[model samples]
Target: MAAGDIIPVHLYLCPLTLPGLSSDQQGRLLDTLPLDEQQKVMRYRMASAREKGLLVRCYLRALLSKAHTQLNQSSLNQSPLNQSQLNADIDGAIGPSEWRFDYLDKGKPVLSKAFFARSQLVFNLSHSGDYMLLAIAKSPRLELGVDIERLRQNTNIHAILNHYFTRQEREAMLALPSTRQRERFFDLWALKESYIKAKGLGLALSLKSFYFELSETECQALSFKGLDARQARLEQAARLFLVKEDSQQTDLGNDPQQAQPAAGWQSKLWQLDDEYRFALSLSSTDPLDLRCEMVSAQALLSE
Candidate 1:
């Protein structure tokens, strides 16, 4: 949480089934959003979708505000400042309306320069079925992307694999026992989504251009049902191979070592529940310190 210091990646998972906000609570949260965002939330045709959108946005703002306050306090504490001045500054938390964002060409949103200048806070969010996840970090050099998928039996696994996965990846996945193929499918899908999202290129970066190679060790690690927040360590689960722009094949052959490792990038995968798989990708050369928490809607609003 200290300014200019690398901090653990903090993951917050909120369930959509939490009690709905009262009208007053909804109004107060809506008031903090920009007009455009407010309209976007309201424009959702389905009431459930609208509520989900509103909750995510408000929870994100609340988390950002808390982080900003901590960063501000840290900076002030490191400087030669009177206790009263520090208290005053810390008390003046960044308001939700004060946050500004800019989107990349493919629509990944980032903090505007004005806010980013204070502290290099970065975050990414994903939602699936009944859950929403937010991953945040506080280092200038860190980039984060997180994905949560509700595994569904009806997914057209072969069609998607043929279209988006590299030849080797498809072969490797299909080689798995029939009983495990569906779980493996979601695992790779979540990992690919996380990588592209972390790169901030969205689907513009072809999924077929790169593939994940989980070592025997990594595969064993991924088998665990849940991650202990204190022991969550991101390892190099995949290597990136850039294909020739005009070529559709990955060309890495059978040996993954033939391709260069994705430097400064780390990833971790976890089975969140019987129906969900989660993946996180981050750009960081240092070892990761990660914390995962399940937060309630009331807790988020109280903060």
Candidate 2:
């Protein structure tokens, strides 16, 4: 989106389906991508992983194509869609130069160039079990991250809680009834992962250093206890983002350059289906207008 556009957060979920997408169709999708991406997809040994990678990239391109078109339409004061032009733009497609991506030192990918100097567009992706999730925001000034996980019964829950959670967090989770404990574990893990992804530090930010305390009304971020000063500083700087309902209380006085904890960070936990949990973390100076959309593998790969 253009600079300062307040586009809704786009969350896409695609199931892993092998039908409909023929070998040639798959090849065509791969052909549209840069050679490096093609090589990476080709390198995946697992069939599901390879296909998931392919579909995720293509779906992202389609969404970007749509976003770019909308951005231009707004600038020209045009209607949301000029059907003919919109279809052509979606199908003909633009090259990747406009949206080339580069990763942070910690492996979080970011847009390398904005359509306008002030564009705030940012996005993040996560995949698990039967679905892959991609979160995109229209603003260039916002930090965005998303994570999805399918419930799994095989993991050692006690070990995970002990290893990754704070003593307080572990106790809190364990206090839940056994049936709900698993769900809570995944919920907390997704929250932490989403925050790390939003910060663009990935796992370089220690999981154990910070924790999210959940309640019916709000999720509180506990003071971080990192091993060193830098992690400690980051933890101290982390602020829970404000939602649309909480916007009136926000004070926009913090200096972005100071790396302070008051940086607006809004988070939400979602239940995609009975089997999956999703979490979103965004760093924006204002409240987040989050939205989610689900698509099947067929819809994503369709002509």
Please report the candidate that would top TM-score against the real structure.
1
The TM-score that candidate 2 achieves is 0.73
Worst 10 residues of 2 by lDDT: 228-237
**In model 2, what are the clashing residue pairs, if there are any?**
119-140, 120-139, 120-140, 120-141, 121-139, 121-140, 237-261, 241-265, 241-266
Candidate 1 residue 48 C-alpha distance from true site, Å: 0.3
**Per-residue CA lDDT of candidate 2, range 1-303, in tens?**
343445466565556665657787788778877888889999999876788888887777666655555545454454566778666545544444335677789877776664324345567888887667788766656777888887899978887766666554577788989998898888887788898888887666666555566766433331212221111001112234222322213322223332223344566776655677778787654544444455555554464
* Candidate 1: residue 131 Cα off by (Å): 1.2
What would the per-residue lDDT of candidate 1 be over residues 203-249, giving only the tens digit for each residue?
88888777777644443332221232312333325544544444555
Candidate 2 local lDDT, residue 72: 50
* Model 1 residue 49 lDDT score: 84
Cα error, residue 115 of model 1, in Å, equals 1.0
